[model samples]
Target: MHETKMKPTINITRLQSTFDVSSSIGTTEKGGLTRLALTKEDVKIRDVFVEWLEEAGLAVKIDDLGNIYGRREGKKKEAGAVMIGSHLDTLPKGGRFDGILGVLSSLEVIRTLNDLNIETDRPIEIVNFTNEEGERFTPPMQGSGVITGNYDKEIIYKLKDKDGISFEQSLIDSGYLGDIKNRSSNVDYFIETHIEQGPFLEENQKDIGIVQGVKGTKRHRVQIKGKSSHSAFPNSHRKEALLAASEIVLTIDEVAKQFEDLSTSIGVFDVTPSVESITTEFVEFTFDARHIDNAIKDQAIRLIKEKINEVSIKRKVEIDFEETWDANGTYFSKEIMKSIEEAVESNGYSHQYITAPALHDAKFMTDITKTAMIFCPSKDGLSHCEEEYTSIEDIEKVTNVLLRTVISLANQN
Candidate 1:
């Protein structure tokens, strides 16, 4: 059994105040946030966060990837720091709670430590990873990915946004470009507290989700080429690419239901001559499949392809299915997970274990160090929209859990 005592609560009012102020930066008319990574609004928030960190007597550092780390020294300055945080960048029209709350709650942990005059054996650091939403950046989690050495920094620097602004140029302009040597790669533990972004916890009537892992994601582009004819053409004589595409779409959806805890979605769809009179001669769409188990995910991929091939042959059309991106499923440290569970128990919050369907910075952090996540409930299983919400009480519960967990880990030799 662990031998640490815990009794600290977060100042909910203060956290709410900070969250409200941040909600205004890059806020949309629909009450959502659009603070893409390294934008002016993002810069404003970073400045505010740094100011708060300095006031709390923490040393702040920014890396070449624009990832921010604020360190509160411990009695043992040489010990690896316990890092806790999430991304702050928001998707276009994204709800304010998704990434913003995790970051602020982490800062709250540090503030509470100061308020109580508590000192630990290990240092504590709060991080704010950049470009987690990939709204402006083509791929999300670039900061975490680059730091983990999963992506080359040169390629990441060369990526251009829709406006032709290179990522490297944007970072330089944001005034956050820092030496790569400062990448706080010496973390002993990394923890993140985020809204569930789905209805799992709320639907189950649980207060906290001790996240076990993140689902692996795979993306594929399916391009279908077929003969084009007028809409009035005989149904028997036509080879419509749209028809084959529709069959594949239905096949994916139908197969998803056959497997438990699997999700398949089509986000992009393009067609040639999409008019009333002309038949679709060309069609392309992107498919995303996510599951925690690689074996099951691969099985699903195989089944989906088999069905797609059946459609291609039956429809007498050519189909090209090519994978564009993939991230393997990642599991958190069992030891860190146990630590979170202990915090949940001490806080007397109802909880359950879950696997996140969406990728997070924590997923990539696991590549470098032991990492875990705490999840508060999202209303109606909705996210990436202005309507996403989690109660202040829920935030309080998780932040308190984070505080207690940090204390325990920091006290460890």
Candidate 2:
């Protein structure tokens, strides 16, 4: 046990050792993790997690989506559990602490409780949500969505990876697929602690972030069509799709700049007949927009659409714009937020209210139960890459706050 500010705290040494062990499972050459969902590496990590949970005296189970759960019984088992969770799967190349820290920290919380022989009035459950990165799956946050009835289980089961392996098959291969009845629906409150994944906390010199909500995201695909021409074609006679697509990309940046908090990008762009000498006739790109307010996000999307049409007319090209996904902003539980704030205050750590730029499983959990999140600062605001880093001192601060918050929520009358 480590003592900080005259308060008993979790064993940071154990937490770091566990993190190092977990990081080695899908280790990339650059020290990043590539533990894709339900892959062999992911399964190995899952096995280790289950083993740790059992060792900690938690009753462990898995849901149909391979979302793993470990429950520590409290005095009253009938009451809804206070749940702490996050994902473990990473991108093809992702930072070490992006998704893994939340799980390890929650596990340490349980270990600390056991060390002190403390019992609350309600049970506590720690979860490892599957496919939160959605690298193999098309959409992310599959496990929590299925358990919450946000996504259709059958459809998710049939979803395939680039290697053509189905999700159900992967679950079977992993041996982690349990019954749907094992899903968590009786959670009284949910809290997830993750890395900030942005520069906000570090730039502000804050130790942690008390997330108020997650930003709304809208995904769309657009195609612009024009006449392909020879390399020798006259510039005035050419109506090229590539130029139109580039203009629309600029419009996305322009529209995003109009709103102080909005972020927009074109992550994917493709041009037909991509030859150096020939002008492309067709172009396609993905349009992604995000904002704290759903209506404002939609407003920006509409403005971009208008700009796309303008580009079409000016370039004399045809445009087809279609929205593929939409997720509205979600606010967390105020009571739980207060608990987290108080815990931060008790720990004497600096923090501020933040609207998460990226979404998490906690965002989906908000629909079924009261959900809140804590964010530790990411060095240089980098994540989903090998460059991401966070210090042990910051992790300790956030974990202690989480421990305090969980104890407070679990014992609440």
Candidate 3:
């Protein structure tokens, strides 16, 4: 066993200060943040993180994907690290806490350990993944995916944003294009802290949420083609793509309602040549569906496809579906979950084990090591918006639990 000083209490003041500094970057008119990955604002926040990590005496390393890792050496240096962290990017006009909280909380954990002069049997790592929101870049979780081998480095680098700026170029512009190679290294365990992003914890009157697993997500791009015609033309000859697209949307909603546990959303819908006097010639929309159960999620997709086909034939319009991304629901390690439960109970905080409806970087980390997540309550269960909020009191409680959990993992053989 490694010798150590007494355990230190969580410093809420420092935690709040960290959040305030990061949130100030890219501040929007509505008081939200817009720190898209690799943007100038994001680079500023990354610098802040680096400064803090160095101040705490951790050796920082950056991989080719721009994923930042801060390592605190343990007594047994050869043992795999116990990793904890989340992404630092945010959606446009996004709330202050979504991904930011996780990164800062992990840093706080390390700072507390430093204060106590504690060293454990295994090294501890705090990571900040890049491009988690995917708002600026398609397909979120790029950094974690690259490190886990879920995506090819070349493909990710070549990906472009709306302005035709390649991902690789953006990294270079931000001065974060490190020469370090990306590799899926060994990790004894992983934990990510995040806002519930839903109303579960607040509704249940719980202080903390021990996430059991995340829901499976499937995204599709649907395009419907039809002939443009004058509005005065007879309805008998017109192939109305917009009308068919609306029907498809309604059908998806109706089919999704059949399963009480399923969650479905259509976030994008567009009609080309949208004029009052002309029939829409082309329609494109995006479909997103998620469910905790694999069978149910797959069934929902099949039903949606069947409905789309039927609607296409009836409306005499050509419709095509292209799947953009698919990730099956993943459960965490049972042993790691037990440790979290013990930590929560020992910390005297009310808690519940629940499934996460939103996808997170932890989903990808699961491929490499034992992974779990801790969720703090969001006021009104809202996220991805400027109004998103979690009280400092709740944050402090969850951070304490996180600190205890990490310490417990670090000391284990």
Candidate 4:
């Protein structure tokens, strides 16, 4: 059984004040934050966060990937520190709570500790990683991907945004360039507080989610090619690409249904022909499939391939598939998982264990440390848009949980 000890109550007022400042940092249309990764808005927000970190009386370090780590040294300088934070970068017209809540809540922890003159046995670090949204860059979790050694630094630098601004150029322009360093053992335990980004918590009226694991994501680009035929020739001999594309779309649903535990989505689709009567010569679509278990994810991928091949052969259309992304699911350590549950129960916040359908940096951090996440409810299940909303009261509750978890880890070690 874990020992029962309580620290001073974290200053909810100050925490809410910080979150409000962050809520307006990169406000976009419809009260959304539009700070994409490595853009001007992203730079402005990162700079503002640096100022907050400095004011909290912590030493800050920026890595080559522009991930910022702020340190509050305790009496034991060499002890492995406890770290907490999330990304500050926002998606295009993203809601304010998606990434900012994790970051600002971490700041609130530092602010509380500094104000109370409470010194733990271990140092505490607040991290604000660059480009967690990966909207400007490609593939979300760019910074954390590099930190966890899942992605190479060179590949990340070469990533380009819509305007063709390279990730390297963005880092240099933002003055975030720093020496590349390995991210390991700087912390013994890591925690991040973020909005649920889904409707599960709010629909259930739960105040928090003790994340069990991040879902594994499989992304594919599928292409279907058939003979362009005359409008009048709509027979089976025509091998119309659009016809085959429709079949493939339906197959996605069929295959997804076969895997009851997984979530599948086909978000992007394009057909070349513009004329209504003309059969499209080429059709392409992207598929994003996710599951918390690798076995189920693998089974889903296999079934999709089998169905695509079968349909292509029957329709006599040329078909091709390429895997654009494969991110594995990540599980949090038992100790950290227990701590999150304890925090939830101690604070009297209704909580449940849920898998995150979206990818997060926490997935990468799991490779290096004992990592977990705390989730607050997203109002109306809105995220990645300007409509994203999470109440300040919920943010405060998660912050209190984050504070208790971090302290519990620090004191135990």
Which candidate should be chosen as best, given TM-score against the real structure? 1
Candidate 4 collision pairs: none
- Cα-based lDDT at residue 140, candidate 4: 80
RMSD of 1: 1.6
Q: Each candidate: RMSD to true structure?
A: 1.6, 2.0, 2.1, 2.1
Query: In candidate 2, what are the lDDT values of residues 1-413, reduced to their tens digit?
Result: 22223454799999999999998999999999999999999999999999999999999989889999999988888999999979889998898999798999999999999998788889999999999999999799999888887899999999999889999999999998898889877889999999999999999999989999999899999988899999799988889999999888888899989998898877788889899889989998897898879889989988988888888888899999999999998888999999999899988999999989998999899989999999999999999998889999999999999999998899887
Better of 2 and 4 by lDDT: 2
Error of 4 at 216 (Å): 0.7
Best by lDDT: 2
Runs in model 1 with CA error above 4 Å?
A: 1-6
Q: Which segments of candidate 4 are over 4 A away from where they belong?
A: 1-7, 181-185
Cα lDDT, all candidates: 0.90, 0.91, 0.89, 0.84
**Candidate 4's residue-wise lDDT over 270-372, tens digit each?**
9878587777888999998899898899888898888888888888899999999998888887898898888778888898888888888889999989889
- Clashing residue pairs in candidate 2 are none
Model 4 score (lDDT)? 0.84
TM-score of model 1 vs. true structure: 0.98
* Model 3 per-residue lDDT tens digits across residues 1-413: 33233334689999999989988999999988999999989999999999998998988888888888888998889888899999888998999999888999999999988777777888999899989998888878999988888989899999999999999999889888775553337589999999999988999999999999999989999999998999998898889999999998998899889987688899788998888999988999998889878899989999999999998899899999999888999998888888888888887789999889989999989998999999999999999999999999999998998898898889888
Tens-digit per-residue lDDT, 281-400, candidate 1: 999999999999988888999999999889888888999999999999999999888989989999889999999999999999988999999999998988999998888999999999
Candidates 2 and 4 compared by TM-score, better number: 2
Every model's TM-score: 0.98, 0.97, 0.94, 0.95
The residue-level lDDT of candidate 3 at 241 comes to 95
